[model samples]
Target chain A: MSKLCFVTTGATAPFTALIEAILSRPSLDALLECHVTHAFVQYGTAKDVYETSAKAAREYLRQQGKETQLEIDGMDFDSSGLREQFKLVQDTKGLVVSHAGSGSILEALRFQVPLIVVPNTVLLDNHQEELAMAMDRQNYLIHGNISNLAPAIKASEEFRNKMSQFPPVTAGKERQTKSFARIMDETVGFTDFNNE
Target chain B: MLPACPALYTTTFLLATLATLLVAATLRLLTILPHTRSTPPPPRRRPGTLTRVLIVLGSGGHTHEMLALLRDLDPRRYTHRTWVVSSGDAFSASRAVAFETALAEKASRDTGEGKEEAGRWHVGPQYYTVVEIPRARRVHQSLLTTPVSAVHTLLRSLTLLYRSEGLPDLILTNGPGTACIVVLAVLVLKFFDLRGAQSRGKCKTVYVESFARVRGLSFSGKLVGRFVDRLVVQWEGLEGVSGGRAEYWGVLV
Candidate 1:
């Protein structure tokens, strides 16, 4: 069983920064054997980030004589192999870090990984920042800015031991009815009602 | 005047035929031309108390149509808010779109065997779960923690449905997201009215052919529209989409 730090999300600019920060950490890569999902690696090639980062990470691994394998298009959401991947994470107390896609986030939580929720944010305005802020404020998730991600990853372990202490879940739809309401009122020629 | 020569007569005949064809083609183009035209400006909207509309335009040309339609609506009578979604983090006019995620799911992370599914589900680079439903049924999808918070979300929909705010005099839609929400809102309001929910008045709903191919009384149109006071459209002589029941609003772009 291997302690996997999985990075399967696409080559969004923020995710690129996340991948770079994690790869450059002094002993962080050694603590958790890194395996990027094909997405980061493949598009990185087209984007050229993949070649540079993978080359750097691979070189470090070779110098250290560790044989942790890197995989592409391998992890599946619903296969015996997926379970094996889950087991690899769980057996070694896996740490799953990813973009803040709800389906992916829910699936990881359901799988019971020692989760490190790295919510994604655009380089510009903090859109995902608000979602991450909402979840983090309630203490339901572990997220931080990419600049502070390394420290945040360090902090996620303490959260691992305390996951059970939290309530079964802290959740509800806090009236995105407002978001959709704004959308509906505008589309249906009902703006006065919403604006009021 | 002398009797007209055959050549002159032939020229007159050709001119008449050309004029008639030109009119017919112009009418046809006017009928199907999507909601973006600067010519023959949209009618001056009536001064009736109007419904405020918030339109969320997706990551392409549809946003432009929404803008054009807004031009026809009397801004004072009917408040218009539009959010135009574009690629590469375009500034979301918080006024228009409340928020935006990537238009659709990206390709990758095919859990176990998701390669084919990813490619099939998305529109090229987009990644949201887009679907088609009737114009009258009402469902509210939002950016909240509980994807479907059964109690709170349901209660919110109920409030929006039976209340003065939810019960719009009319809801017309362009994007699938907006149209679907309008449809869901209609259904919820109707259910509540039957289940002892109060309503000040019945609301109207309109659907365009761009989003659906209605015909033979859409189960959705009929289902949601039954309680709805009216169902409207832009074109005349719809044989299927609305099942001949939708009121033709005369080619509203």
Candidate 2:
């Protein structure tokens, strides 16, 4: 079982769940491998959930007398180097979970990794809830509500199996491009190719 | 009636001829004044400079070009905030991810919706308009929630009705399709005070002409270029398009 879970959070993520997951790492020490990243702190954001999660994880490691090997660091997310982080996730042979940002999700998809998304909806009331609910509409994501995250991550048969699939077929749409060309030709109609 | 005054007749004829000629000359001068001066005044320097600008992205390659220019702004002096007025196409999710920017995508019937409504699926003004009704909008909300409702919603719904209301300031339009609208929006609010309209818009419009010509002479650029306060040609070559009429501040995003 490839059981490494790496999370790099933005200013907004499900921090309480992260704290809970990280704090309870010892309990699952024998069952799974965990790598929790606490990156949300550096960016002038201090939510109780993220702080608690980071603190709990640190305390748990200290109690167990084990060195904390989880990669927790500050990052400038708006920089170009952010792409390398996704590339790292791609190379890792394990379950992948990312906070819902179109970039991350798209990257995960490009790498063909099974991705579980925890939307930034905890910060606001938005259509993300609907998107999370509509997972079956397209095989893009498995919503990270967190309650089912452990089970889903441990055995996300749907996403795990479909990792090799390409994005939904867009074959017929090419004809539309041709039709669009026809309309353009009809309107502007005359072309002097010898404008050169 | 009293005596045949030959001197008086000649004097009267001369005076009448002079008066007629003077009147004709004055009337002719009046007609030419409006046309000769109708080229609009030369663009003037705006008060206060922009440090951060939020540009809304539209269909085709406009969104792509916008995302590309966003890569060039200095983070200290300017923060380029972008929101794509997008739809649920296969491209949206990928492009949104690629740009690493938040998208305000909604179920617009087509590109026309953004021209007048808050946020809709309409990709560009070339293809869409605002035709939303309450019942239809409710159905839209029920079916799709991705299309966001921001200040843009009210601005769009009320644009033509109260076009002089609160609208964005200094909209830096770079797309070929949305030119007429940017001009209309800028000119409409130019008469009245609105958000970002008077100051940033002292006709302060930023455009990259090479990026703009998706097909040919961007219709929207040509149209809106007439009124936008500052028309920025990203390339030195395109400075001619403004034809010495618009003020060129080198390459502006």
Candidate 3:
């Protein structure tokens, strides 16, 4: 019954800061408090960065004498998508820490795991911050700061029960809201004669 | 005096002809481009009408969002799908194929009686096609040569739209340069009324802004906003974008 914490830094641009923040001492203490055992990181083209941070994290864990309690590992990228990783999080009722990429956010939310979205502020004309803020405001996710992710890690315990559903059951109930499928049919002028 | 009089008459005639042509072209443009504020009521169409839909998918986020948006697409309704992908975007192309395969599986699962057709249900060459056109503007492509690639994309799009089977009944796209060009090509077909494109109400476009665009429309969204029949934004804050044409569908995809 080992609880897992999965961290994905996205595939294209590596969010090295996220890796460092997640493995920092404060973040580790928060994970231990939450009883998380296995810490998995999807580094994605940041092998050197991951190695450096992971080594320091291991050293800190050794000094704290909690080396056996929490384990850490890393992988490059998953071409077939992160379904397996997300599924593991769901089974364990674990947490997912990800860069503020909409694709990852959308996919991870479907699994109903508590997610901490950290927006990489290094990129030029970055829209990730705006998206993370909006989603956070909606209570769909917790927006984590790259400088210190411990607060968000601690917040996940309470936020898990109250997390809003993704692809909401009824996004807008006031005015007849429609699904994308229905919209496509409407755009094409196709009325469902068969009621399908 | 006779030579001067003839020259003046020739100049007057030429000016009048140019004015008439300009007026006609403007009227044609007005007819072709989608109305900014309002869309015409969707004409009634019966089920299983052999409808075709053209989907524009780009690399990475665009492709992912497009697939998510179309998660519940009915293959029976949109019988033929022409997936337009950028030339080097193998991921998008393969994802399109994978999506169709998933559709086939779902189709079989929904109707147990059609279990035998599961192997070929709404898949293969008959049900869908993946078309690759050159990128409208490759990443870091020099501004000087962008027009050249843009023209190439427009021509390729035109050829794809003018198939023998007929034009797509609907063109569904998200934010992508290739999608913008495809929408432009559809407008061109309608402007000339090529094979009754506008008269028959073919090539209707629906552009969905990316889910990541929370504050404002993306660059492609701004470009194709006015021309597309429907500009759908997932976030509420972006509802009135593109001169109040953006529709808020509440987090579609």
Q: List where candidate 2 sits over 4 angstroms from the true fold.
A: A1-4, A11-44, A47-52, A61-78, A121-124, A135-137, A156-158, A164-166, A172-196, B1-253
Candidate 1 lDDT by residue in tens digits, B188-237: 55444533322433343444332122223333444444333334443234
The reply for model 1, stretches above 4 Å from the true place, is: A10-14, A27-47, A64-88, A123-127, A137-139, A164-196, B1-176, B179-253
- Model 1 chain B worst lDDT window (10 residues): B125-134
Give the count of colliding residue pairs in each prediction.
40, 18, 0
Residue B100 error, candidate 2, Å: 16
What are the interface RMSDs of all the models? Answer: 16.3, 16.2, 1.2
For lDDT, the strongest prediction is 3
Better of 1 and 3 by lDDT: 3
Task: State the C-alpha lDDT per candidate.
Answer: 0.41, 0.41, 0.88
Fraction of native Cα contacts reproduced by each candidate: 0.02, 0.00, 0.80
| lDDT tens digits, residue span A1-196, model 3 | 7999999999888889999999999999999899899999999999999999999999999999999989999999988999999999999989999998889999999999999999998988678999999899989999999998898999998999999988777734675567898889888877653333
Please report how far candidate 2 places residue B183 from its true position, in Å.
8.8
> Against the true chain A, what TM-score does chain A of candidate 1 give?
0.58
| DockQ (model 3, Cα) | 0.75
Residue by residue across B1-253, what tens digits does model 2's lDDT show? 6338988888888999999988976665443222221234324312122222335455434544455445432221222222324333334335545443222132222355323322222223222222221111222354354234322343453363244322332344555333334445445454443454444333334444432221223555665554554444433345546445433333222
